[model samples]
Target: GGGVAAVLSFGVANRLFTEPRERGRTIGTMGAVVGIVSGGGALLGGALTDLIGWQAALALPGLSALAAVRVLRIAPATQPRAERLDARGAVLCLALAAALAVLLQARTTHLKESLVLVLAVLAVALAAATVWHVRRVPEGFLPRLVVSNSRFVLAAVAGFTLFAGYLIIQFAAPRLILMDHDLSVTQIGLILLPTGVVSAILSRTAGGLAHKVGPLRLVTALTVLSAAGLLLAALAGRQPVALVIAVAACVSGFSAGQVALMAAVPHLVDSSVHGVAAGVFQLVFITGGSLGSAAVGGMVGAMSLSTAIGVLAVVPLVGMVAAVASALMVKRQTQAPAPAAGPTARPAVGAE
Candidate 1:
């Protein structure tokens, strides 16, 4: 599921648009669709689970997949290219994910100490191997140009960090609500519905604004808003109304920030490498989400859920700093003068 999403996100966005303005609009529209589906899915799932059964609710995603087949047929195909599969990189990534999952389980559950130690060692080994492999290979799994680009790196960091914060909220909120307020699954879904709606609206608007104000500026501002929302959620405690407002703000900001980062991808990398760049970007984005959910879940097991959520709020502030740094880098790159023409340079036809 993760692999497919990463591939499709990069392939579709890269193939569909070239110019930044158009890309922003397209990416925004994509975000809106995702927001709708994600938000609506919760409501739909709850209704299905109540009316029918858990099995019926689980089947709904398959139906949506069948519907998506028609959309897939309309997608343009790319020219064939001879590219080596990065099998070692793929294995290393999977190992890392598995090890991380085990470690999270160890932290949250009463697992044997020896098992936890072994998993920790395995996770460290996988991380070291992935880094070494990337540096060793000429044409590595990730493109060198994409990795070296400061703006792209910062954007990736911002995306990962912001998503982590968002996922933490999603993981912790429902549990907190149920524990404190005794809300049913359906009631919890309803409480969270507004967040998705606001996110969908902001995501589309942010895309157009990214073209006008620049993605970094918009992302930075939105990230700060998200941070503020997290802080509010941290302080809200058991207040249902406050929690709803905070969730809406956080989701809206996350949606906008996501659109801005994605819309900036084409501008950051060459057209030819968009597919690879997008894949790397989404890989990190997805990894952040997993780490966020795991880390916060573990923390909740160790301490009060409210305290864990409060600490997790700091993640988005870190993302805001990365966004600001990206904006500064963009400004510097823009202001740097073009190299002076050499003697052999062709003269302008209209030279005075």
Candidate 2:
């Protein structure tokens, strides 16, 4: 639960640092650290699990709690407000998400036909209810200001698809290597270890690159890189080198794209709703990742794993359109006609 709760803090990244470049740099450094640590952990996890047991592979994340304790000193203070919780809207939103989750899992879980029917009905009902609630209360559980923004949508979609691709690679690579190679668990991890190295290097530079290339192009390029990785895995993944390259491309794109794009959220949305925007983006990230893995797991039984991955590539590709649109939107926003105000009035940055 602590691990899950930890995701909630992701929104704080935007809140912590105000400067765009600084935010980018910090997020990139974070990506680097995570990549390096994860790479080492992957190599070690295999050896440790074989030697000590699976429990050894799982004990390390607990250390993050200690890091959190020290971090509290720098955490932002709470701003008390008297607005009541939108319990009805919250319940509706949760039900809607739950319904969608059930549908995504249905294929993998292979629920009974009757159960599927019930779930389908529940999903429709929940969807309608949630939509009605949102319309009735635009500023309720899901704020209009947050959800309606194109940039926020891109952030959500980018995180969603990038993570989907990330999860797909994670599931596909190890399985591919184990099927063809007679390598030890540790050896397989070693083969996959370079993904982390590649990811770390790219992550470290992503911020500066995004600043240079602009968010739209950078995100599209990364998405293309990710899709190419998936395509390689589908077409030539039997070769260990191909799989390694595939995973590297996929992970590097995910790591760099996530940090760079998220850092740009402040430029797109109002400061008051940064938290909401971040929360929505991360929620979509988690959902899309789950759905991505679920898509692979559900389809691999009926289709080739490679084909499933090729199909999965569409997730990021669709997100690329959103990313491009987001960039265009940013351009449009920046180019808005200056207010025809008196000389005494300063220009205000519009936060739609």
| Winner by TM-score | 1
TM-score of 1: 0.91
Q: What is the C-alpha lDDT of each candidate?
A: 0.76, 0.78
TM-score of each: 0.91, 0.88
In model 1, which regions exceed 4 Å deviation? 344-352
**Considering summed lDDT, which 10 consecutive residues are worst modelled in model 1?**
2-11
Q: How many backbone clashes does candidate 1 have?
A: 0
As a whole number from 0 to 100, the lDDT of residue 289 in candidate 2 is: 67
Candidate 1 lDDT tens digits, 1-352: 7446645765676677777677778778777776665566667777788788889888875665774586588677877768877788778887797789668757678778998898898889999988788777636676677877888888888888777777777776677677678766677788777777878898889977887898888878877877777777778846777777777667666667768887777667777777777777777777777888888888867888888878888887888898888888778877999999998999789987
Clashing pairs in 2: none
Cα shift from native, residue 220, model 2 (Å): 1.2
